[model samples]
Target: MSKIEKLLKKLCNPAYKQNVRKEELESILNHFFEGQWTFGEISGSHNYRIYHPYFKNFPEKFGPEGFLTIPVSGGKFIKHFYIKILCRFINEIKEIEK
Candidate 1:
């Protein structure tokens, strides 16, 4: 397996399961963006735009409402949490691309 895939598996291990906290998510994001410059660079122009939509009901895949549903906990937490997950997903995709 690729380095990114291995990193993702380690980050999303069953030990943590779906109970990933804000701190853990932040750490994941930090690691993912350690060398990356921008979200567009990490996820590609098309996917970066799709992942960051202003409208909620634009589409199921465009938003994080589908992939992550970890009990609402204020707007800040929700925003950062989804951002981290998106970064993780994009990193995984980059691994596949390699």
Candidate 2:
């Protein structure tokens, strides 16, 4: 797995099963996805572009909702799984803030 994937999985794993405070989860989401804003460059950054795609391929393959409701059937399956978990974490954070 790539470094970015490893870190994302690590972050999302806690959010998925643990009871993290809303503030920390927001910090994690913003820092990892929005703050860094590059893919495969920074150690903990994901291409923010992944969530807002201008092109069709990302959405077509992963779905347009920015979260994987169903499984992604391909290589790098674990990374995609973490991405879904991350999206869910982000949503949960938003819900809590509201």
Candidate 3:
């Protein structure tokens, strides 16, 4: 697999997730999707969300409301939760790109 894919796979695991920072994952989403997606806060820095065109391709179980929660108050460790969410998101982006 490619380096990005490998990294995302590692990040998918709970053990390696805590090492990720919000800025790093946010950068990946921003850079990977570029103009095709939108990023914004639902309520300033206290809450956030990401929207992408490829979300339409997601499976029914993933939900059609089409939003991912970004936690902002649980310290750095909480970012680990986000890693799992975004890793799935990035994986979807990868498949869509292919």
- Highest-scoring model, lDDT: 3
Expressed as tens digits, the lDDT of each residue in 1-98 for candidate 3 is 76656666777876774656556565565666555434344434544555676665663733585655566544443466767777777777778678
Identify the superior model by TM-score, candidate 1 or candidate 3: 3
lDDT by residue for model 1 over 30-96, one digit each (tens)? 5544533222344323122222222244346445542223332442232344445564566565675
Give the TM-score of each candidate. Answer: 0.34, 0.29, 0.58
- Weakest 10 consecutive residues of candidate 2 by summed lDDT: 68-77
| Cα shift from native, residue 8, model 1 (Å) | 4.2
Compared with the true structure, model 3 gives a TM-score of: 0.58
In candidate 1, stretches whose alpha carbon ends up further than 4 angstroms from where it belongs are: 1-8, 33-59, 63-88
Tens-place lDDT digits, model 2, residues 39-65: 334454333333433222456555665
For model 2, what is the C-alpha lDDT against the true structure? Answer: 0.43
Q: Where does candidate 3 clash, by residue pair?
A: none
